[model samples]
Target: MGMGRRPAEADTDPFSGGIFNLNESFSDRIGDYLLGSPNLSLPVADETFSLHPFPVAAPLSTTNQETRASNGHEAAEGYDMGISEQVSATCSCSSQIVVTFEMVEISLHLVTAPKGSPGRPSQAAAMNIEEFLRDHKRALVSCEMLLGCETCSCRGEYVMLVISICRKLLHSVGVMHREGLSEVQNRDSSRERGGLWKLDDEDQAGVLEVLLKIRATRLRRLVTILDHVVTSHDWPAHRSMTQDLVRRLAEA
Candidate 1:
């Protein structure tokens, strides 16, 4: 007799004629459907489904490593750029400071006077007083010689005028020296008393005024001496010296 198959076993059998194979039939129908309707899509075993194209995500470990490497490279580049900028700024500031220092030095040189220059007030004052005293003494001697000269007949009025000028210059010098000594003594006494020795503006102005007046008087006396020498005609050499003195005084 032929072996009989059970209903459950027949349903489970792949070769059963009543059963349909969905895998084979669906694959064949999918191609037909895609061909008939150009927009249709089918599911595939090795791919993920999506409405739009997208890159497949990698495993978390590999993705994290790649990201970290990229971030480290970017950070290195940024750090290098920052260091270069800071170096450039430091160099620029150093150069600016050097230039500024040079400018300040040049300004100081321009403002300060050289040593031993005639513009120094103390030196000028001492030299002027010495020269003035010498010139006055010489003029006095010249006038006396001319007055007593038997070779030339000198005018009495001119001789008297020159002598008076010389005497007046000598008197002014004596008075100025006495006043200066007194002022020095006063200053010393004030310092001994523990007082600060400061010159007031008004006192400075008054001293300057007196000095100007003294210079004016000296100039006048020099002019009188020159006039006497020219009018007396007794000393040609002395006339030249007097003229030189006048020129020096004017220059001063």
Candidate 2:
């Protein structure tokens, strides 16, 4: 026995109250619409996968690296050039040399007041007198010795002049000693107005004696120096002048 075919409405349009179109293929038309849609063609999956965007950097080439190094070297060379110029200028200034010379001067004065005078002698004053006299004596002795030596360049006339000066100094010393003795003798009368005790005649005489002894000692020293000058060497050219100076000093 053969099977029977379905009814026409049931086979053609069951969902639309049994209505159907017979000309088009539905599955093929749906496939074509999906391929042509603008929304479906966009890359939505790529945008959704990455939430943050990042910038990409390119790698440096060898030529660019070399150019940077050369620029740095040129900058360093310019800095060093300035330093070198400064150093050279400093050296030039230091190369110049300078020298200087100085001279010194000394001055001395003698004290002639008696020890028994109104005012007592200061220790400093006494020391200064001694120092001055010592230096003066040393200078005179050295000059005399130099004149005596044959190797010395000093002339006989110069020695004679120096001896004359010494004689004058000795006269001045004598005058100072006499004044000191007179001052001691008169000091008592001068201080009487102040009610100070007057020194007795014996005391005055003792002070004068001391002054005389000091003068005698100085005279002896001067005579000894003159004798040394005369006997230490022979001055044939200045014999008469030397003798005259010696005679004058001895009389003083």
RMSD of each: 57.1, 60.2
Q: State the lDDT of candidate 1 residue by residue for 36-132, as single tens digits.
A: 2334344343332221112222222212121113554331111222233343433232222223233333332322334265443343333232233
For this target, which candidate reaches the highest TM-score against the unseen true structure? 2
Per-residue lDDT over 34-152 for candidate 2, one digit per residue giving the tens place of the 0 to 100 score: 22222222222113211111122222121212112355533211122223334333322111100000000121223444444433355344323223333334334433433444322
Error of model 2, residue 179, in angstroms: 2.1
The C-alpha stretches of model 2 lying farther than 4 A from their native spots are: 1-154, 188-233, 236-238, 245-252
Cα misplacement distance, residue 246 of candidate 2 (Å): 4.2
Candidate 2 residue 142 C-alpha distance from true site, Å: 6.3
Name the TM-score of candidate 2: 0.31
**Lowest lDDT 10-mer window, candidate 1?**
59-68
